[model samples]
Target: MDIVGDSGATGYGVVDPHNGWVAKMRLAMPNTRINNYAHDGAMVSDFLPGGRWPDTTDAVRRIGVDQPSLVFIELGGNEYYIDRDPAQYKANLETLTQNIWQVSPRSTIVYETIWPFDPRQSTSMHSWDEYGAAMQQLAVEYSAGWIDLRQFFPPHYADDTYTHLLNTDQIHPTDAGNVVEYTAVLNIINRC
Candidate 1:
C-alpha cells in the first residue's frame, strides 16, 4: 500500500512507529509493505506539474512506478488554509485521479476526506463541508473509494468542552484519532 497527501497521512509513523497512522496500518497488515509520499503542510498544488517541489520522484511519479495494489490520498486541508478556490481544488483532484489511473489502472485508489480544522485557529474562508462534498463527488466520478473521516471525528465548534478527537492544536488528530482513521481504512479495505 502507498499513501500520499499531507501531515495526516505522513506525520505520526513515517519515522516514529509509535505515533503515525501508517505505522499502525503496518501493524494491522504486518506482511504488507507501506510507502508514504505524504508531506507536512502540502496542498493540492504541490502534486501538480511544475509546482513547488515538482519532480519525477514526487508522489504521482512514485505511484506510476511502484503501482502499489492500494493507494490512499488525504489532502486538501492546506488548500483551505491558503484560501484556494474550490473549483481549482476540484480540478487538481480530478487530474490527480486521472494520473493515478493512467499509471496504475488496477490499483485501488481511496480518497480520504480532510478532517475538520479548528474554526478559532483558522483564518481561511473555505467551508469543510463543501470540500468534503467535492471530494466525495470526485470519488464517484473516478470510480474510487471514499473514506469520510468526519464519520469518526465530527467537528464540534460550538462547545470546546466536548470530548473532541482533535489534538490541542485542533488541526491534527491525537494518537487515538489516528487509530480511528486507520480502522476506517481497514474496514473499507475489508469490504473490497
Candidate 2:
C-alpha cells in the first residue's frame, strides 16, 4: 500500500529529539509493506501549477505505473492554507483523480478527507465536515473509497488536533496518530 501525505507519513519510523510513535506500528505489522511518500508541509494545490511541489504525475512516476492495487492519497490540508477556493480545489482534485485512474485502472484509490484541527490555533480552517462531504461526493463520482480520518479524531485531539499528534508543528501526526491512520487504511482495504 502507498501512504502519501505531509510530515505525518514522512516522519513515520524516523527518530528525532522528540520520539515519535511510528515505530509502535512496526511491532504490530512486522510484514507491512508501506510506501510513505509524504513530504514536509505539502498540499494538494502544490501538485497543481504555481506551487513549488512535485506534480502528481511526477510523484506517481516514481511509484511504478503498472497499476498499484492500492493508492492512498493524504492531501488537501496544505492547499487550504493557500487558496480557499473550493471550486479550484475540486477541479484540481478531479484532474488528479482522473490522472491516477488513467495510470492505474485496476487500482483502488482512497481519498482521505482533511483531518480536524483546532480552529483557534490554525490560521487556515478548511471545514473538515464540508471537505469530508465533498471528498465523499468525489469518491462516489469517481467510484473510489473515502476515508474520514477527521471524524475519528476529535475531542482530545481538537484543542490542537494536528499539533497534539505532532512533536513539532501542528501539521504532522504523532505515532499514535499514525496508528489510527494506518488502521483506517487497513480497514478500508479489508472492506474492499
List per-prediction Cα lDDT, in the order shown.
Answer: 0.78, 0.61
Question: Please, what are the lDDT tens digits per residue for candidate 1 over residues 1-192?
Answer: 888788888754233446577778888788887888887878767777766765423778788888899989898888876778788889888888888878888888899996777544366667878788889999998788999998777675646653345677777777767778878888998897
Candidate 1: clashing pairs of residues: 12-20, 13-20
Query: Against the hidden reference, what TM-scores do the models get?
Result: 0.88, 0.74
- Which regions of candidate 2 are displaced past 4 Å? 12-33, 48-51, 54-57, 64-66, 119-126, 155-168
lDDT of 2 by residue, 1-192 (tens): 565566555654334513332344345556865555667677665554455665433665544544567777777665555536566667767776776666666778888874565433356545545555666778899888888887656644546543454435444566666667767766776687
Backbone clashes, candidate 2: 2
> Candidate 1: global Cα-lDDT?
0.78
